[model samples]
Target: MSGPFVYVPPVNPVNYPPSPVHYHNSPYLASFYTDPNSPFIPPLSLSGNASPYQSPNTLNSPLPTVLTPNAVPFPASSSGSAFAPENPWNRERRVSWNGSVAAPTVPNSSWLQPPMYHYRRRSDAAAFPFQQPVDWTSLSPYAPYRTELVQQSFIHPLLNAEDRRNDLILDMSCPSFAPMRNIGNNQTAPITPEELNQLAFYPQAYGAHIYCELIPDLPIDIRYRPLPGYSPIAPPLKVGDILAAIWNDMQLGISQEMWASLDENRELMISRAYTKRCKIWASRGFPSMRNAGVKKVDCLLGKVFFRGLVPTGDEANTLRMIVA
Candidate 1:
């Protein structure tokens, strides 16, 4: 009680019994007393100067000293903190944003030459072949008719020459010369030979026959006709004369000079020639050109032969016509 009071926990009787217990009548005397057979108990002390008892093993061992931030020694290269110079083993390898290993910082290194890229040159032999030159004369309206005759001479083994020629002429006749079929009935009355012969005088029909020979693949409804109100400004020629000129020009190739002379008025000349022909056919007691439902067929023959003319208002709405 003379020094600072130290709390001592009561010894557990089950774990650390001081001595054997005995029954005694005297209340003042302790019921438990130290027995000679029991283990010895050390006396407790309360003195200020006395040291706490320790086991021999603990007394012989050195105590561990706690490290403080300032007391801790760092590597020579470090800043004397927990964040020391990074260990070479723990240092992360540098990489590029593209996931490639970054190049070393050393300049002009042996491995640092610019990347090699190879490009193959194209060979002259591999180049595309030039197309064969087109024959402008072959596009003439009479070309197919002439070709048919030539082909017939070689190929017709069954028919006699006279019979073959007659058949060819009959086949070459334009379908436009035939009478219009009734819409309600598929059957058409057979044409008399006289009617077919009389219809031959019409230049429009004749032109159509030639035009059909020129472009057999064109639909019957879309076969050629003259533009509505065209008139020849330069060389004033009749319909028959114009037709003859065209046929002759086709036989002998059209000259650049002729085209240059015609200039912007070529379409007008072509149109006027066709219009005059249609008028002549109409005046001669032949069915009027308008009666043949030819209004929709305003394609000029000159327009078909020429290239790069601006499309008319009506033509602009339709797909472009491909020149032969």
Candidate 2:
């Protein structure tokens, strides 16, 4: 009642049209909505007929027919062209532009034929210009042929009939060089069974034999000579002394039979020890066994020591005898 009057504008609410209802008459939707879990349903045609279900894949569609131009047959003969139609089988003959049949330069059969090889005989003068061919017919059967040293070496007059028979038997079984038999005579006696047994047990003696017989008695050149005013830590050793020490050390703890029966590895160890001892002794101003004379003595001693047949006291004497 006490406030001043204020002017107010008229307010009117806007009228809007209602949303239209959507009617889904599509057969696909009708079928789908009928069973949500149903498989795909093709839509009906506008003609009110349910069309047959066709695969959505376009691969099954019938291919469009393509129209091609008709083929024109070739004429039997053409005067303008150089080539003319002929039977495919008749490859050797071709009709020329002038209507004359021409034969091929090369026969058709020759195309598939194998290559031919031509053999040329060398002239005798080109093969052997300086020498004349031997006439085998003119050679006499009784003429003595040049005998080879190897053949001559095999001919031993002392070979008995029994030994020859054994050799023949061995040749039949296993062909090899004839076995060496003892030449029995008053001067040279055959090897005893004991010696054979010893040799069989101590094969290392073969190396001694090789050193004594096969190796030439050439003097070995010394690489290092004894220096003047040089004092050695140990006394100088002879080859015999060095070998004796090695032999003693090899059988120090073991019996003679056990030492002989040592395995290959044990033997190798012993050999290495011997080589070490040699080097050590060489440092003491000793003449090394590398020297030929010393080496020969070493071989002889090696055979004697390994065989264990000679007395230890007589080793030096035996070595001297062998060297002499």
Candidate 3:
């Protein structure tokens, strides 16, 4: 099955009107400026040459000249923008994240090294985990982190003792927000040894990744599937707790970015993720971490309640046969 996917909105509207023009300075801005309420831009010297479209009739007002029918489109400026100079799309971009935090156990990481840092292997599926500390220098917190909090853990607790099975182990599933590489500060600046120890203290405490990197073959969003055995059959008292959380999320949906802030700062994360890469890969999409941008992650988390139109599932053989 594919991953859950959805339609994305355009950053800029289509069939957009030509942007308003902003001449650095127009001599006419003084007498015929369209908006006196707005401060006048300092006038720039127009080369002595006359504009081809400067006609006596249109010259009466600065704003009218701009809308003149015979006006030749302004010569494109090479340095600034493809869209009209005043298009909001041309504004500067600013990316921000939580402040730079040092990991708890700062190992020698490539993040500390110069550009094009080297990456190395750390985790092996066959090997027992948590026997000793993982050398995370080879990995980066900014990259998708894969801790033990994979798909199995999501429904594992809900599983009955007899129904529980680890055969379908998932690696890149529940990613919390904490322990993310410092996108805001450490991105450009080098971290001190002290910050290293602070970041690694318990990276998993941050919470789950917004998008689950489960089965690789499926579309990231459309393929929402959970095993029948995954959801537990809790007795009575626990049902109320589940009901409350459902009410909170369903009736009171939180903004994805706000949730990320709260999730990363939580005293205790429902789960954790490791920065190490796994040796084995899964066939289906499970809840796991993958390289996703903040906007994409926000979109994924925001649609927490979206459902698929087709039959999304992990039963490969059944799906293939149905397609046939």
Q: List lDDT for all candidates, in order.
A: 0.29, 0.28, 0.26
lDDT tens digits, residue span 23-42, model 3: 22211112211221011122
User: 262-304, model 1: which lDDT tens digit per residue?
Assistant: 5566446645644654565566454455443222122334232
C-alpha root-mean-square deviation, candidate 2: 47.4
- TM-score-best of 1 and 3: 1
Predicted candidate 2 versus true structure: per-residue lDDT over 63-137, tens digit per residue: 332331222223453542223555423558665588567674442353343344443445755867776565543
Best by lDDT: 1
Indicate the residue-level lDDT of 90 in model 3.
66
lDDT of 1: 0.29
Candidate 3 yields a Cα-based lDDT of 0.26
Q: What is the C-alpha RMSD of each candidate to the true structure, in Å?
A: 54.6, 47.4, 33.0
Instruction: Report the error of model 2 at residue 282, Å.
Output: 31
TM-score of each: 0.17, 0.13, 0.13
Sort all candidates by lDDT, best to worst.
1, 2, 3
Which of candidates 1 and 2 is the stronger one according to TM-score?
1
Clashing pairs in 2: none
Summing lDDT over every window of 10 consecutive residues in candidate 2, give the lowest-scoring window. 168-177
User: For candidate 1, what's the RMSD?
Assistant: 54.6
Point out where model 2 deviates above 4 Å: 1-138, 146-324
